[model samples]
Target: MNRKVGLFFGTFNPIHTGHLIIANHMAEFSDLDEVWLVVTPHNPHKKKSSLLDNNHRLEMVYKACENYHKLKPSNIEFGLSQPNYTVNTLAHLQEKFPTNDFCLIMGEDNLKSFHKWKNHEVILENHEIYVYPRISSGEVKSELTDNPKITKINAPIVEISSTFIRNAIKEGKNIRPLLDREVWKFIDLMNFYKK
Candidate 1:
């Protein structure tokens, strides 16, 4: 009712089918109108070396999401400080786009560690959280009972991950179907993740 828009933040070292599916489903099944793929420049939880450059990752996300009208790739973190934090990004986005209501999109796996994020309480207070199921468990209601902004969605789950794709590429395996053909082609042409 508040012009819902989901902000799905991630490294997107390379955007894959699973990521796309969740975004599409969230928009369709939930109150969200669209989902933005906020491609992070750096994630505090992961090693910086393993991440492809932000531009490359952004390009892959662009190609992967080219066919989807509702899915957008944003380099919002490129202008922010390193080791981007969710709350800070949300605050900045809200200030810049005052009219749009943002919902945080995440998987059940990440929700387990969500409490540890920087100013995570501030995030729950400002945004709605939409989570998808994971292979490890069933749906988990928001752990923080006092926080009413959280909502878990019962959407279709796709177990694929970027880690597996990285491993496949490192092992010299085909990944054309695992990701968008354009994305796979771009990665192949650029020889990304070959090292």
Candidate 2:
């Protein structure tokens, strides 16, 4: 069997401590050989405004993951067309890296709405999903909870969010503890998220 790779998809408007903590936990504690932080160029459900440029967000990710051996930064979805779906990205990744077993890393909240995703069943059939705990309101379906392909990791629940980080920065709050040192430096240098 090939090495297992966990794909962590996010806008990563700015990679913060919470994102790193969960990613590092999965890498160090789980069977995944490495975790790729896939920087999304665009998310359909989210508003376009208030988001940093694609490259800016990606740069922060790169800086954040620079020292992480098992964690990587990926701009894979950047090349794909806009409003791309998870299934399509998975298919593309599998095609490009046939040897690496790519599993998805998601939050507990996403699992609740997994059925609504386009071709959700196909994704489940083809790849494993690793879910981390999150503060959400819904209950997960029994069929999904019973699925052998889905694993709920006992990872730390990161209460912090990128939005909080961005807002804090804009308000001239020191959010150093919530972000990687390099990422903070990059954001500060670029004057990002500051209105």
Candidate 3:
């Protein structure tokens, strides 16, 4: 069997401990052999002023996952076309890494709206999806919740958001506890999020 890798896609704009908790929990508790933290590229359509540069964000993810044996940082989406879709990324990753069986790691909240995603059906047909519970208001339909390819994992509900962290940093609040040591150091040294 190919190595089962869970792709946890995110912008990771200065990856925080919440992100690490979910990634680590998935790696340890799920059937996945490895969890790659895929750093999503900033959309060209959105104002780039608020989002950190892609390299900076990727570097933060790299630092955050440094000591975790099962965790890895991936910049696979960076090479893809702007405004890339998950289905396309899945296809490209499958083509490039045939030896690895990739799967999607998503939240229950996202699963509720999975139907609206571009080529959602194709994604479900090809890859397994590991859904983690979230403290969100919504009930997933039985169809999606019952999919054989979808597995619900008992991962912790991390409520931390990158937006909150950024805003706290701007206001000079100490958020070192919310982020990894190396990540905090890198961000402080670079003076990021301090508008």
Candidate 4:
């Protein structure tokens, strides 16, 4: 029998509570054996200047996921080419771990721009996509809404964003509530995001 694993891809700049909540929820309710947090070294859609070092980000994810037996922190994208594309990552993972059934875990907001991604159709055809709710302009719906491969989960809407946390930290504001306790401690100890 194939082990079902959900790929929760992100920069995880500092791995916050919101990310943990979503991954944990997906693992428990989505019939997934485990949720792997794939940390992207550089996302094609995001600015590189705003991101922390890949190793640092990976460490933060490790700290946040330490207690979660089902959540695994992955640095698989680190060896991949620059401007990491989701399709390529998924493809590589499938090749490397043939026995594992990989599923894509993302937020509803990503569905809005899903088509623009490289080889999105291939991704949809090969893997199941689990999308969680996000605070957006309107009720999040996608062209893939009718597709059985795409599963929309009513996960909690976490309004907190990595960008917001970074800004708050730079300004010396309290962002403890927005982060995992260990992650917050790591950030504070390393003086991350300080201007």
Candidate 5:
């Protein structure tokens, strides 16, 4: 039988604790066998300068997810075109791994801002989407699509964020709890996010 995987795509600038929580939760609660952390090369809406190099981000993701059996990091977007879109990546992944069933796992925060993604409907029409809650926000229409493949999961609402971690690091504050030990060590070794 083919494996069912969830593609959790993001810049993952530093791959913090919240991202790990969501990926693990999706694997455990959703109809997915595992979750692949598809680290994006770039996000159009965010400043590229704020991002760690794609390879570094991938390394951070790998370190953070290494102990989690169901979580793995992929650099699929690294060689792709600039300003990569979810729809295109999904299509490429489907074509590349036709036998695997891939799902889109995202936070409710993205759903709220989904309209901004390119070819959002194509993504919704093709794959299952598992959305974790954002803070106390109630049900809101997914800006991506009205397709029925979207499912809301009652996972932990971890308040940690990469932006906060970067800011803390820049200010010389402790970020041990904000990220995994291996990831923290990697960041320190490379001096990542040092403004």
Candidate 6:
């Protein structure tokens, strides 16, 4: 049987508890062998200036995910071309790991803009998508709701975001609840997101 691996792609400027919670839930409830947090070097849709160095972000993710046996930190996008698109990364991963079946893990908010992504149709055709709910994300439209391959899971919703955490850190506010203990320590040691 082909092992099912969920690709939870994100910038992960700093990995937080919310991320780990969703990943762990996916691993337990979904038909996935493991969930690999694919840390993107650059997200096409997000601002580059707001992001930390890719290596720094990667290290934080590694530190945050150290205790989770099923949650892995993957730097696969670093080797791929700039402005990494989901379709291309999926293709490359399929080629590289032929024995494993790959799935996409995203939030319902992302589903709203899914069509805007490059080659969105091809991505849907090739892989399964597991969408968890986001607090502010309104109802998923018929197009996505009707899709057979899209599996909607009732994963815990945490309102925390990387932007919120970064701003708190920049303002010298406490963000201990938002981040993993080791991740917060790494950020302090490295002086990350400081104004």
* Highest TM-score against the true fold, candidate: 3
Residue pairs in candidate 2 whose N, alpha carbon or C atoms collide under 3 angstroms = none
**TM-score to true structure, per model:** 0.89, 0.96, 0.98, 0.93, 0.89, 0.94
**Regions more than 4 Å wrong, model 3:** none
How many residue pairs of model 1 clash at the backbone? 0
Better of 1 and 5 by lDDT: 5
Order the candidate numbers by TM-score, best to worst: 3, 2, 6, 4, 5, 1
lDDT of all the models against the reference? 0.83, 0.92, 0.94, 0.88, 0.84, 0.90
Question: What is the clash count for each candidate, in the order shown?
Answer: 0, 0, 0, 0, 0, 0
Candidate 1 vs candidate 2: which has greater TM-score? 2
Misplaced by over 4 Å in model 2 are: 43-47
Among all windows of 10 consecutive residues in model 3, the one with the lowest summed lDDT is 138-147
Provide the lDDT at 128 for model 2.
95
Residue 152 of model 1 has an lDDT of 73
lDDT of 3 by residue, 19-129 (tens): 999999999998999999999999998887869999999999989999999999999999999889999999999999999999999999999999899999999999999
Best candidate (score: lDDT): 3
In terms of TM-score, which candidate is stronger, 4 or 6?
6
Alpha-carbon RMSD of each model: 2.5, 1.4, 0.8, 2.0, 2.5, 1.8
- Model 2 weakest lDDT span, ten residues long: 42-51
User: How many clashing residue pairs are found in candidate 4?
Assistant: 0
Supply candidate 2's per-residue lDDT for 139. 89
Q: In model 4, which runs have C-alpha deviations exceeding 4 angstroms?
A: 43-47, 138-143
Worst 10 residues of 5 by lDDT: 136-145
Show model 5 residue runs off by greater than 4 Å.
43-47, 136-139, 142-147
